[model samples]
Target: MNRWKKEFSFILALLIVALLTACGSNGEETNNEQASAETEASEELTIAQINWAENIAVTNMWKVILEDKGYDVTLSLLDMGVTMEALETSELDVSLEIWLPVQDANYLETYEDTINFSESTWFDNAKVGLVVPTYLEDVNSVEDLNEHAELFDGNIVGFDSGAGTMEVTEQLIEDYNLDFELQPSSEPAMLTAIGQAIENEEPIVSPLWSPHSVFSNYDLKFLDDPQNTFGGVEKIHHATRLDFADDYPQISEWFNNWKMDDEEIGELIDYVESAEDPLDGAEKWIDENEELIGEWVK
Candidate 1:
């Protein structure tokens, strides 16, 4: 009977050990499953990027960053109006550059309740109006543009026809009673025209904005808008679909936290313009500025 009792106790101890081991294995499996689920939570994202140089630089920068974090990102180069429409219809995940209180006021007013606008700014001090090369000594301000319209070939070179600046420029011409025609062209075309003018040392005035690398590449001055019709200094904001936060809380959080000042944006635009592949430049920027990016994601 004593031997039998000892044997029974040994078997009972072995069974308890086996049960504990099985429980431990199950607990580890549960943890791993939870981790995997978390890793897969955020879905692929679509970014609606405008073709403006600054917008291109910022959007591509985020593309590289997000892809590195295991998120698939697609960029659609669309005009501002279409971009805004996509955001409103939930067809786009995010719009990285939305100039506010002036430049993009029309769209924002239309979609104010439908989309989400970041409370903060990626960049402030954004002003838009006629811009002239600093070498044009006679041209000082928007009011002065009319006096020297012939010097600029009777042209107020404008940006994308769909751009808010062009819309405001139309108002500006009427408001100031300027005799110059606001030439409707794309941003690239406007820049190229301006560049050619610069090379020839010819005078040119166009709808341009600050926080643009063109100002750095060529000495340019923003013709002062005394009437504030251009709407003073504007804020560059991130506009996302209404459900963006819920669908991609992490990315939405990153967008909300991300902040780039004028100098940073100018540097990015410079690098992108110089690089053969804009994504390569964006990656280089990210690699060099890991600490700043870490703060953004954190």
Candidate 2:
């Protein structure tokens, strides 16, 4: 009887040891999995966003999409010049709208060595030039502006001074030998001026771009550029740091495949403008266009 009892006690001890070993192995695996997940969650990307409507819309859209894919994304609001500089120094990962061959030519020339532009343009029909309300019947071209300088208070309202479009406008003023002054202001301020002018049937001229919600909201016309000061239809591209593609291969691939038509971008801008938070608008658009987004992300 004594031998049997001793044997039973030994078996119980063996079972306890086995159970403890199994528990310890599981705990280690759990810790390892937690660490791996934390590492993935910590991966981050920063995008520079210009305050232009299309840039705001697209930037927010990407922010939401990338976040859903386990990336911590940040958007920095910056002027056109500052954005280019940041991209050159590798401080920014991406810029959604970099108008090429015209508006942003100077920036491209300055940062070409350190910046990389996507081979594919996201928007192809982009244009920039002075614009006026349709009610200004006699003012159909940039040349007409000089004849009716008094109507616009001898001033051509413009976007932020750092905008590439503003740079081209200054050249336009010089090229045409216009007597009017170019007043640099924020986009929202320019829009407000235009809106107020239209409400009272007053004449107002300002530099404007396409793929903007303003075109849909107002009866505006682009003053014909006889000298091609603003250049022909410009293509909007994605600009990134030189090493961004190498660092984020998957995102680069998605960006390369991205393209948006006028109607689509217009809708996105409208949605964004209507929402209290831009991200909410972007999320709503994404939910509605899952199939379209899947093609790029896939």
Candidate 3:
């Protein structure tokens, strides 16, 4: 009977050892799960900003603010068309320069499912026009220009051949029955002609747009388009991926809260346009507008 009892106790001991081993394995898995949760909580964010003056300024402004708030922020490249595609695919987390109801409106509606853009911070200070030197009072409107096509050398100065504004200007040409050739050249060439004309106090007209500091730099005025062929004044804004809210809520909030005034952005644009150093211009504006910068935070 003692031998039988000894065997039974030995079997019981082996069973206890197996049960304890199973419990230890379950505990390890739980600990692993907790570690994984912590890891997911510590991810970084990426943002895309286009090459435009206002875009660079506001984007860098947000970048500075986000980095200050302990986000691991990264920047990516953006083109006019490529940026939207990136935002749609979630390859880019955020972009703060979506201009609405124009060239980008169709894309905005199409990609509504993939990204969300807030209109509260949207600014509406942009304008497009056929402009001339401030001294040209006679050429004050699209109709006014027909009498002076000979004065403007029978050619309407224009930037790159394939620019959308050029397309609009061409349409305006057909619509108005203006007797002028749309001179197509690079931006530098067009601006060079304007500079030379301004120095000579000669007549000059070209396709121009704003929040650009061109009006401030040189005495310039936009000719009135009674038919509104070039479109209307509107704000440039931001669109970010749907994942932006989930992955980087803090950064998203900072960007959503950030905005700059028309004048403030123009000063930054002038600085960059003069020297071609956009980031430094943005930083300089931030330094000069300490009060405004603080307000943007609030």
Q: lDDT: which candidate is best? A: 2
Residue 194 in model 1: lDDT: 92
The sequence of per-residue lDDT tens digits that candidate 2 reaches over residues 199-276 is: 999999999999899988889999999999999989988989998876777788889888888988898999888999
Please, what is the TM-score per model? 0.86, 0.86, 0.70
lDDT of each: 0.86, 0.89, 0.73
lDDT of 1 at 52: 89
Model 1 agreement with the true structure over 144-248: per-residue lDDT tens digits: 877777787788888788888889889999989999888887888989999999999989888888888888779888777889889887888899999888767
Error of 3 at 7 (Å): 41
How much lDDT does candidate 3 score? 0.73
Candidate with more favorable, higher TM-score: 2 or 3: 2
At residue 167, give the lDDT of candidate 2: 89
* lDDT at residue 239 of model 2 (Cα atoms): 86
By TM-score, highest first, what's the ranking? Answer: 1, 2, 3
Per-candidate alpha-carbon RMSD to the true structure: 4.6, 7.5, 7.5
lDDT of 3 by residue, 169-284 (tens): 98889889999899988666888899999999999899887876566769999899998887798666677888776655545565566666677777867665555565666667
